[model samples]
Target chain A: MDIDTLSEKIVAGDRRALSRAITLIESSRADHRDQAAQLMERLKGAGRQAIRIGLSGTPGVGKSTFIESFGKMLTGQGLRVAVLAVDPSSARSGGSILGDKTRMEELSRDPNAFIRPSPSQSHLGGVARRTREAVAVCEAAGFDVVLIETVGVGQSETVVAEMSDLFILLIAPAGGDELQGVKRGIMEIADIILINKADGDLKPAATRTCSDYSGALRLLRKRPQDPQGFPKAMMVSALERDGLQKSWEEMTALTEWRKENGHFASRREAQARYWFEQEVRQGLLAKLDTPSAREAMQSFAAKVAEGGITPTVAAQELLQGLRD
Target chain B: MDIDTLSEKIVAGDRRALSRAITLIESSRADHRDQAAQLMERLKGAGRQAIRIGLSGTPGVGKSTFIESFGKMLTGQGLRVAVLAVDPSSARSGGSILGDKTRMEELSRDPNAFIRPSPSQSHLGGVARRTREAVAVCEAAGFDVVLIETVGVGQSETVVAEMSDLFILLIAPAGGDELQGVKRGIMEIADIILINKADGDLKPAATRTCSDYSGALRLLRKRPQDPQGFPKAMMVSALERDGLQKSWEEMTALTEWRKENGHFASRREAQARYWFEQEVRQGLLAKLDTPSAREAMQSFAAKVAEGGITPTVAAQELLQGLRD
Candidate 1:
């Protein structure tokens, strides 16, 4: 089938077409990239309805459990939902087994839900590019909400945050030890922080953890990219299935407020601009990978490694070759 | 003066020429950049003697206090010391006042010590460039120990780490609240973790924090760039002038071990490669800012911001213009 036909099928809410479109975006072949770009251009006129939410936390932070409960609650509201994981480890390990839908049996069984494992073959940058496009496909396929699940470690968190309207940073009770280890920029980018497992014997610890985060959040300088009401802390229990309802409501409310303030559209535009800059860099790099340029870079790299020459001088030489 | 004369003066251990050489590196003018590069080329075989160390922590971590005491001890051993800072906050705020020598009165007065505040004029990347050159200058000028002091916050920490032979992450005692908020990638990069302010009542808490960090360090995958026998934790009383000996001993031992195993040379080569890649990107951005290309980029940016086109498409258009 032609890409236009594929675009039409995806816009008409065809899950099979949506999945295929995502696969096209994930392909590294030159022809496939052109086709994917053309298909996106074709779908450009289509409106997006999904509330794109980025959900993240350190591994073993009950991410799968939270998504299971959260997806179920959203689907119960007569909403179609899609869950997409961004797993860099899967790429490294060549196995997308970690957050695959079999673990979320309840959500997997729901007719209104769709879950796709992360692409396990590419580097982090490529995975991010594919995940962002998959998000667009899900939004076009009539899903009311798309939850991008990414581990809160390293570069993955930043990538997921950029693709979402509201970012939810999830944690657990008595996690002060782990919290001390939270990456520097994660809290600043977080829209809402939820203390999970806030039930039974963990209740007091959860409340204390919430208070601690709240205090810490207060001290943070509000980052310009964060939704204004962000850095706020709340409590929830994925197992008890409590607080999931309020969490959904809050997520939607924040989205609505951002749209009303024009931040939603502007945020998307800014993201587009950022990716555009990145593309420019990548293109320049590709141009510099010609045989001669490669040899120059390699020679300079060795000289620099051996301390025979400075990197600045080598850069000057390779940059000259790019001009030639 | 000619670049060769300037290089000759710097190599002859002239402090005036050393400071001016640093200023030359920090210059943004294209001609000065060329001159500085040429001067570095001229000094390639002069050899380096200084043990370069990167020291970083949050603002309240008593960095200046620690450095002052540490500098005194080194100077007491008849070693000439040079302190160079990478202060992004100072850059943004238009003041290098924060880490200037006045904050370390004893070090400022030490006849054998040389201190230069961070260049208040450039972004972190530019500052880092100047700083790496400044380290070279200080080394040529016969400083036995060159300390690169940067705030423990943001990208500056990572940049400072790459340019040095060893990186020390410093913090105060009972800093769980602060630890929970450490910038990601930092703990993994640190060669040594020191809990300063270990004198008086803070001693026990310092020991506990040290143990906590040690346990955490044990869980981290040791980075290949780290010096062998590192990621070690220690306690220091910079104020009481105690524990300084052990800390210095460990740092020198790690440097010696790394040099013996050739990791030191390999790490510097990797850093050179990393910076070479960065310079390519910067050079490409500069090209994009040329008059015709700038106009195209602006038009595309406006279109992207107004939602007239997706950023990827806009990027494609602008990049096409660059190639043309």
Candidate 2:
């Protein structure tokens, strides 16, 4: 369909149209970008009145199970929810392949819930940009909540934390050392720490782990008004849906608190500012291979590589050439 | 000293002079940057003369102890060594006040060894930039080897990986679950995996963890070749200096292999290209806050926050106002 038709459908709150429009934006074709930008401009006023939550955990911490249970709980409360599971993309292919559909199979079938697994590009910052853009599409489609799942390692956790109003970190029952390692980074940013797989013999261990994290977090100064009202460590059995309701309630309360305060509005504004900077950076980099610059850089690069000159000097020379 | 004087001293292999020059480069003062860049240009001809190695691990995983033992091993072989430790900066003060001098008490006294712990900036990329710049200074000072000590968690590992030729990921004796958590993202990039504290009762556990990681790594493609050689996994008792010699020998072997194959030269060239892109991106972003742009953007931002306009349209409007 044409850009005008898609833009109209997206503004009218059509989910399929919104999804199609996002796919167009994700396209790398030069012409597609202009079309996508225009469509986005037309649908600019279709703002998401939805709450966005970010969830992070190391691989195999049952992030899928927790989300499935939590998504079900939200649906039970009659809230229309959307899930954006971000899969790490291959550096070579630059495509995510959207592998999360199989993990959230149950949630995907819910009519009130929309599940979209987008490929996380090579960099966390790139994935975050796409995810944020997709969330806007999801919001315009009238979803009440958008839950973003990040591949919880390296900078992805920070990227997710920056974009979401509420951030939850999932952990399992590994003792003190595991607790120590977690304390080093992502755990500090967590508004809520959910100790998953707290069933059978692991229940007691999960309780102990929760207490350890709670104590560890106390040493970390209170994160002045987290999206959530307070830092909480809760044990949840996703298989049995035990404590799922409590987790949902906490998430809801965090959303409510962020909205009532000025954080929700401020964070969105900050995210937009971040996106603007990223886009400019990306745009200029993409244009580095433009004919005139490429011709000037190539000859200078060859000389530097041959040991006739150093890279730093070569760069300065190239900048002078570009300026001239 | 003036830029030309500092550059001459560093190129003349004055270690103390080189250290002071690096401090000037890492300084945030605007004038210091101009001097540092000029110094870097002068020293470009003295590039890639040292083997750059990265060591990462959890705090208690004996990173400092391993480095001490390892540094002694290299110095014993008549090699002058320099260690650049990236210390976590205070989030509030943005200054690094870590007592690394106290941490490496013995090594600090070694005339053949130089240990400097630079405070990590708010951005991991910034730390990498300064460390790369420092490496150039150290190499020009006639240090045969450079070791970069990075904190294990978050983006620190990735940043360290990019800047070093050989990356050693230090893991402790946590079983399957912990291994499962780290098998992706940053850990997957390791060229060498060392299970530290492999002594006493922990020996068997350390051996098992090494084997487990080796098995998991088999699922990934072979570790990237260092200009020196391919990476490996080993068990080491940093306290006892057990396996320290083997690790050192392997590191040396890899460095030789890289030089002979010409991979070392090509890789450094690529790294220079990467750093150039990062500098341009950051430079452009700093310009985004020019007085007129900031004022116009702020007023447009207020409208976006009040829901009178969307961020995309508001940004365009602000840019237009600034241009006008």
Which digits, one per residue and each the tens of the lDDT, describe model 2 over residues B1-324? 777788778777787797798788778777877677778877776654788888887767887788888888888889888998665543335665432767777777888898887645765556667777888788888888899887665666767776687788887777755674563665567878889989999998998888887776666666445432245578989899899888777776876787788767777776666666555445434445578766765676666556566454555555545446
**Residue A13, model 2: Cα distance from true site in angstroms:** 6.2
Which CAPRI tier for candidate 1? Answer: medium
DockQ of predicted candidate 2: 0.15
lDDT of 1 by residue, A140-208 (tens): 888999999988657888989888988999988875565565665788788899999999999999999
DockQ score, prediction 1: 0.52
- Backbone clash count, each prediction separately: 3, 6
Can you give the DockQ of every candidate in the order shown? 0.52, 0.15
Q: Give the TM-score of candidate 2.
A: 0.68
Per-residue CA lDDT of model 1 for B1-324, tens digit only, reads 898888888888887888889888888889999999988777766886688899998878789999999999999999999999988887777888555878899999988899999887656777887888888888887899999998865688898988888899998898654456555578878889999989899998999898888877888887764665568889999889889999999988888888888888777778878877777667756767578876877778777666577655666777777777
Cα shift from native, residue B246, model 2 (Å)? 2.1
